[model samples]
Target: MAYPYDSLLPQVTRPRTISPLPPSAPGEEAKDEEVEQVKWKRPAVVTPQAVHSKRALLEKEQEQTASSEMPRPSQGELFPAREQEEQHRQQVEEPEENGQNIKAEPQAELPEAQSDIMALKRKNKDDMRRVQEENLNQQRGDQQNQVSERVAATPLMKHPLPSCLLTNKDHVQAELQDSEASNKVREKRLEEEIKIIRDKANRLSQSLQKQVAIKKINLQGLQRKQLTVNEIMIMKRNRSPSVVNYLDSYLLGEELWLVLEYMDGGALSDVISETFLSEEQMAAISRECLRGLDFLHSNHIIHRDVKSDNILLRTDGSVKLADFGLSTQLTPEQNRRCTLAGTPWWMAPEVVTGQPYGPKVDIWSFGIVGIEMVEREPPYCNQSPASAQRLIATVGTPKLRHPKLLSALLRDFLSCCLQKDEEERWSAMELLQHPFVTSAKPASILSQLINSVKKRKKN
Candidate 1:
């Protein structure tokens, strides 16, 4: 406690040091004199960039070695001076400030000028290879997309229920059972709707003094499948109320499907055959047909076949001119069709005589149909179809079976329609203004005829 102040002051302490063990193996090694002498080798100090460059150089050397047997790169192929001596001379003759270069030494060189060309060749080869790989990947992607689209487009069989009622039934019975079970609710709903429609029609007739045609609706699902391209085109013609409506078109399986308006009144020929129509009724029918023909002619279409068979009627008193299978379209400048394409009996004298006819030919056919309305048959229905054609070609004009039954004005209209000179034939628009066509209201007249025919058919 009584030590000097200097000794008691805080002092800095040094760290304790431990020495390593000394080596003594040299002495034993010296005793073994037969051991080979070893030299002290220094390790190379390599950076990350140097290692990468070394790898690239090795790859280049491997490529050059391979190129001796395989195809060389485009750049290397152009320069053939790849000899070792030339390389050495190029290395020794450095670019000195002189007119000519002399070799300073005999050693191969890594010329910086050639370095750019080598780098460019290597880069181009790599880019070309990468581009080819990308193209291959794109092609693979395209093929996969096409396959997926095809699979998505194809329809597979889908059973409705999880459990099956395999109660020892045949194939037909099984199908019937399955169909009934699936559509039972839908069928009941449709039956109720149909009942409502009939009741509404009856109620409207009683209360509002309006009659509606209540035909049974055919409720099969329409599919756009199995229709030919030509049928589709015909169905999708330019629409007028006189023309049938095309609702939709689609593709199913290997076919095209078309949905069209249901024309239930049957063919015009059936109506004519089933009932004897009055003159006013005949005039009304001719009026509506002329209207349709006028519309078609105005649009530059030739209804080559114009007969009762091609006309259609709706339950609610609408007339539509149907069946354009043989119809031809004329250009804005053209006015004639040279082909003879009408039905043998309905063909015009001009058409039968193998003359170039225009929309006027349709006028002749309409005249025959007018005659059909009065006679209950075409002009030469008793004759063979061949004979009918020959008669049409040679005969002056078809005579109505009962000319006394037709009024003088009506007879004159038919005469205008059946004119031998197409220049003299009454055009559809002009025929629409005829005194015969003006005698009746089309909707009421035709509707009466249709209702009577329906009653006759039912009886």
Candidate 2:
């Protein structure tokens, strides 16, 4: 039978209830009329609680059906829904808390991080500034050191002491004044010492000059005094009043020193050069020279170089024959000397021609000395030595430059001395007896001429 509100209610699927018919007769067909009828259930009343309960019951029944249909999970594999829900909630809540903490932590530490960055920047700036300052200090120190070294190396006069030693101005000024005063004193002392030294040096130079002049005079004297051993022996052997006296002889090292009589009037050549000789003066000189020659010839010693230069005079007018360096002894075995020697102007023709000659060669030179007295120089005085030799060799007799000025007696005497042939030439003994020599005044009168020459030289 159907209910009245069944159409208004939701349809619910339910199992049908049917009463079984009496066991059907074996092999007998069941008739419709014999079957139990299906009973219709009545609809339940609808309420909020009932509806909720029914939905719950339906969900529960669906779960039971699904549970029954699927295989059951093991206990270890099973997770409770409540526990999963709690875990999910905790995960979500933890993320939210961590996100908040992350945001809050950054916000809270922002100022401190900024402060730390500022501190690091400050430290970097401080370090850079310190390094720059150190570099600047080093540069300043180097510059100061360079300046100090320069000051030290420079001269004291160039770089004076700094006056700014004291902070007080007055003190610095006083100290500078004192230093300047001391420097002035020192400079003055040094200048005085220098002046003294200069004066001493000047005196020393003058003394040295005087010593040199004396040495030069001695050297000239020594030059005239130089004598060979043969000459010295000859001199020692023949010490006549007319010949220069050799007082002593000494050998000093390689040089031979002879102390001879000093002739204050100097050589006859000096007198001839200074003044014109009168015939009488010439005669006197000739007589003295002839005497010396005669003495030398008698001793068998030939005075080869017989010139006015070899004739020296004293202040007392004592004439003597000097400089016997060329004198040679004539032995009886070799009575003639063939050596070509003697001054070219006065050289004999035979001597010039390399012919054997004797003491007559001295007479020829004495004749030339006489010519020197008359003419102030011999014939060919202007010619060179070679040219003079050539003229002497070629010319028979040398002509006097002023023949007219000479007396006949003087000319005759000169001709006798200057003969071309050595054999024809008058001997020194014969010449000493000639009127020209015999007529000569005393040798004491020659001092007047010497004094006059000295006066002229002084003027």
Candidate 3:
């Protein structure tokens, strides 16, 4: 089959150099018409140098291949893009000059393929730049994340205090804690102290209550020991009117305590008025009464209420004065009697006259008591207390009846007992030696009375 022109094989035309028209005879015109005709082909001329360069490169490749164990290069590998650019430029310039026919598709194909290489290089560079940028950004992000993590994990740091300020602050805190602890300890100790005080107060209150109870019991016991008035009056009714004896007494306590010796014999006025007393009875009662008074006076005690009701008779008929409730001791001046006290009938003239009386008044009252005993009634018994006081003021002294019936010794004793003057009164000891009470009978009588009282209670 015949190939179409479009698909025909390419034919290259080359120009050969004719021997330079022999330079015949210097002026012979260069053959204008007959000289050797030279044929020029654009492709041949244009490609020849390239072909030689390719041949040299191929030789180098061959040499490299022969010497090395490496494989031979491909046609494209042997001629680098730059060398290919120079070859294309040579080919293009020749074609343009010679108006040669060229395969447009191959030339265009070459430029396009080269542009692809440039594009690939640019793309690769862009990819590399992008990758590097991504790496940088990734690093930045990682750095930012790390910074965020650190910021989140760690607390912000504060500025440091000065060393002195720090030390002072620590010291102050320690002192404050110490003070609080000390206060707590003090509070605890105070609680203990309060508890102790409360316990003491309770115990003291209990002790005081116990003491009051004991005192109350003791006082009740003491009050219950005495006899009742009704029982005493009954006993007095049974006894003889003139008898005064300890046998009529009552025992008052569990241990036979507080014996009340009887203080009766009717009244002294009754005893005297019934009869003029025998000398023996007069001497006995009078001397004993005086002795009792002297004993009281020596003790510095004043019997302010000495009277017939207070004069007691023993069972054997001896006399003893009693009831010293209103008595006073002159030893203490404040104890001096200020109140008027005594039987009006037997009151001393000084007492009746409203004079301040001391123990000496006892002597004057004793004389009056003596006068009543001898006569058996007070000298002013018929008069009222006021009239008797007036009588004492008007009369100098009292007189006793039956003065002649009385023995001289008894008379003198009675006179001595009735002496109106206090200084003239005999002391109880002086009267003890007087002929009246010197007999052993009164002493015997006292002993017998105490024994009788003791025996009566036992029986």
Q: List runs of model 2 lying over 4 Å from the truth.
A: 1-227
**lDDT tens per residue, model 1, 235-261:** 576678877655554333233334456
For all candidates in order, the CA lDDT equals 0.69, 0.73, 0.56
Task: Estimate TM-scores for all models.
Answer: 0.49, 0.51, 0.38
Per-residue lDDT tens digits for candidate 2, residues 314-418, read 777889998788888999999998987788888988888888888888999998998889988888988998998888999868988778878999999999998
Name the TM-score of candidate 3.
0.38
- Poorest 10 consecutive residues of model 1 by lDDT? 34-43
Could you say which candidate leads in TM-score? 2
Arrange candidates, best lDDT first: 2, 1, 3
Q: What lDDT would candidate 3 get against the real structure?
A: 0.56
Q: Residue 122: error of model 1 in Å?
A: 99
Q: Give the per-residue lDDT of model 3 (tens digit) for 319-412.
A: 6665443555565655445556678877766677776656766766766666665666768889999998888777847776777766778777
* Backbone clash total, candidate 3: 2
Clashing pairs in 2: none
Please name the candidate that would achieve the greatest lDDT relative to the true structure. 2
Q: How many backbone clashes are present in model 2? A: 0
Counted clashes in each candidate structure = 3, 0, 2
